[model samples]
Target: MTVALMWEARAVEGRGEELLAWAKARVLEREPERRETFRAPQDRVLVITWWDAEYDAKLPELPEPGDELVTRTVHRWRFEAA
Candidate 1:
């Protein structure tokens, strides 16, 4: 099975670039099959990682950034390939 984990966060005002850099620098304990990062107009950053694992299996995920880096809590989701 294949699982995709999505992590999204909104950085503080005018800090989108810094947030994107931070996200890109993060290293998972175990690398995923594939990973990608994206940014939007609202200073939001999105990261998606695809893994070879069962839906309910334990997996490594990006941790929340420091409180000063974001405006609110991060959001995450998981999906299984059809």
Candidate 2:
């Protein structure tokens, strides 16, 4: 089975471009080593990411360092493929 996850989140305050770049690097270099990944969308204030669908369940388990949005503007999606 293959899993795909679509994530959408915003950067807070000083965690803007720097944070986005970091996330992009992780998506481009690291995450795919574990599974699969789609290129990130570097536009607007939202940091969009895609990776293994199963990774969604591991979100809270990961180190969510950097800016954590305290607003309701964050949106994400998880999709699984057979």
Cα-based lDDT for every prediction: 0.98, 0.43
- Candidate 2 displacement at residue 53 in angstroms: 7.7
Best by TM-score: 1
- Compared with the true structure, what per-residue lDDT tens digits does model 1 show for residues 1-82? 9999999999999999999999999999999999999999989999999999999999999999999999999999999999
How many steric overlaps does candidate 1 have? 0
What TM-score number comes out for model 1? 0.98
Error of 1 at 1 (Å): 0.5
**How far off is residue 13 in model 1, in Å?**
0.7
Worst 10 residues of 1 by lDDT: 60-69
User: What RMSD, rounded to one decimal, does every model reach?
Assistant: 0.4, 5.9
